[model samples]
Target: MKTVIRYPILFRAHPGRTEKPKDVLVPYLHEHDVPEISEAETHIAFRSQKYALVEYDGRLFSKVGKPGSNSAEACFGHAFEKEELRRRPWWIPTIEGDKVYIRYAGQPLDNLAYYRLYLDGGDKARETMIWPALTPDYQRHLGGPRSRNEFTFQGLVDKIRDINGVQFDAGREEHRAEAERLIVIDGSYWIETTPPAICVAHEGRMIVELSHLPNWLDHDLGRQYFPLTAKDEAIEYARRAQAITQRSEEPVRNFADWTDFRFDDNPLFAFDYEGYSLKRTTFLLGGDIARAMTGNGEIEGKIGSARARAVLSAKEGARSCGADYRTWPDASDLVHDVTDAWKMTGRKPGWTEIPPKRHEFGTMICERAAQMADSMPISVSARSTWTTSP
Candidate 1:
């Protein structure tokens, strides 16, 4: 997928203006006609020089008057350079191969003229660095100094915001509120862009950009809605969500210590649960356990197959243990299956053992189970007496 940024202002130049140049000039000089030398001595005189101005057919051209000047050598040199010089240079007429040639050994007049006109201004930096780097194609794209597509860094922030329709401050608050309303309507959602990046909100209060997060952590928080719980376990749940998304590594050693990086306390990450209940807690817990067990930590290899097996195993275990509670499996049984599958697959079992005495949810599950068992009647009369007393 192509990368997307939340605010387009982060890029160096406007997208519309940064296109590659089309009219880049070729580096090497082109072939041109050589002027005839009037005599052998003239050819010999200019043979030692690299360049010469030649007068030929009442017109002048710059020709390569290299050594061993023969008639055939007169037809080749840079045509562009000759044009730039206005066909004027001091020359001596000579004969070579019985044809007249003009040879002059001097600096390229056109280049000197160009330097005097364009480079004479106090823009040494542009001449020395920028101008040299610009190819003929780029120069054509530039079209000159007054072209509309020229890039400028000034007022860039406002320009970016205008182009991308991004909100800030008070406007951002409204956007955040809308996001929270949408999340409550659905469970969770992704805010997509052309070049994609992931950003999430919590309770319309905090926004986090997953792109800035570690790859493992970002993948772990796979686009999903989380259940709200007590602060500690909610954070733990978020961490586990990340781990489940990871599917390759052992469970985190100290989930509490993990950081929850946020961009700001904007409405973008807000939640509205004024009428919600805690009944789904068990199911959410079961889902988390199932997710945690499925894959090895590695990003590549047979993660898909492993996760499939883990899910199947968890379901089977839940059924055998009579733990499936309609919408979700039993949390305890799910955790057990997940750990067993991880061990079977030669992966680290990251979660704490079940029937956990100190674990927050584990202790809750055990206490709840014990309470139910105690409430059951030992005999028919005992059940009747308890019912009557209640």
Candidate 2:
């Protein structure tokens, strides 16, 4: 489940000459090009880098840039760094060998200079950050001294209301003229221009990879471990949704507290120096059990409302994955949604959907389990120290 925030953007479009409308495969538009194209605009917040950079040449064929000619979806690709190209840019399907360009229809800058990046920032924060971080010369490419203008921070756009409606052709010349006049006032799309750094994991579910991230905080290491940093967002969300409200949601999970047992083993890293990706830490040890009990799937249906579903989930999770959820800090919400779904569904609280797993937290490791089974008293160290020794 996902919600996209969209806004209006001014886009240039090339309606092919009635004779060759489909032949307009334009990437960069210039005034010096054969002819002019039409313009459309709108927004996507919670998204897109709303800023557009248009540079026009007052000199010569600066008069002939046909930007919208390549309006078809087939002509563009992503503006990936050399490192990203090898990774199969999330948006581009072409392998490293396929030649393609980033698709940008942000605005109609026809009859203008030629530049490839139309609406940059598909790389999310990494891509969007480039705009604000540009040096004075490039940042002030707007020509005059408007205090080095950047893409103006236009406000958010409501994707639901400010939407692009049906597409229709300009049937007849007179009809086209009337349509143009009507569209100016009553169009499906707004005439303007912009997810946070979020990506749907390959499992095909909406996982918020970022939130509240200031682009300036991004650097080499942050970028390198983005796959890990994203975990912070996920963990935070998990805390909010499942952790007990009264207790501090500061992470208490074992993995979250584990120091590097060994760095070279790659337990704490997303990618090695050689660019080889490593196994990412899997944090949700118990949630999957709940999901399994309720028969919920990544894309399929499940029982109950969000809270009810959560309740069912938590109880089910707590029942089977007892070892992890028995007293888990975050299990509160799940067990309730973390409380009532099971009861609401007429299932008893003592219900065990699966074989129960027990948390040994009440006892110490190595000796406590055997001691508890043998009915031996647990011994405590006289000096309360954090160290563990045999």
Top lDDT: which candidate number? 1
Candidate 2 residues 25-98, lDDT tens each?
11211111111222322111221122222111210000111223332221112111222222222221112243
TM-scores for candidates 1 onward, in order: 0.18, 0.17
Candidate 1 local lDDT, 1-390, one digit each (tens): 111111101111233344431111111221122222332212111121232222222222233323334421222111123331322222222222322333111112122222222222222322222222233345666564222112222323343322322312322332232222111001111111111112322221222222111111111112222211223434444453333232324342332122332222222223321101111222223223343432324412333555445445543432232111123223332333333333344432222222211143233432443343344445433454454435
Supply candidate 2's per-residue lDDT for 283.
12
CA lDDT, every prediction?
Answer: 0.26, 0.23
Q: Report residue 264 deviation for candidate 1 (angstroms).
A: 20
The local lDDT score (0 to 100) that residue 298 gets in candidate 2 is 33
Error of 1 at 352 (Å): 19
Error (Å) of candidate 2 at residue 286 is 19
- The root-mean-square deviation over C-alpha atoms between each candidate and the true structure, in angstroms, is 34.2, 23.8
Runs in model 2 lying further than 4 Å from the true structure = 1-66, 71-95, 98-390
Query: In model 1, what lDDT does residue 274 have?
Result: 13
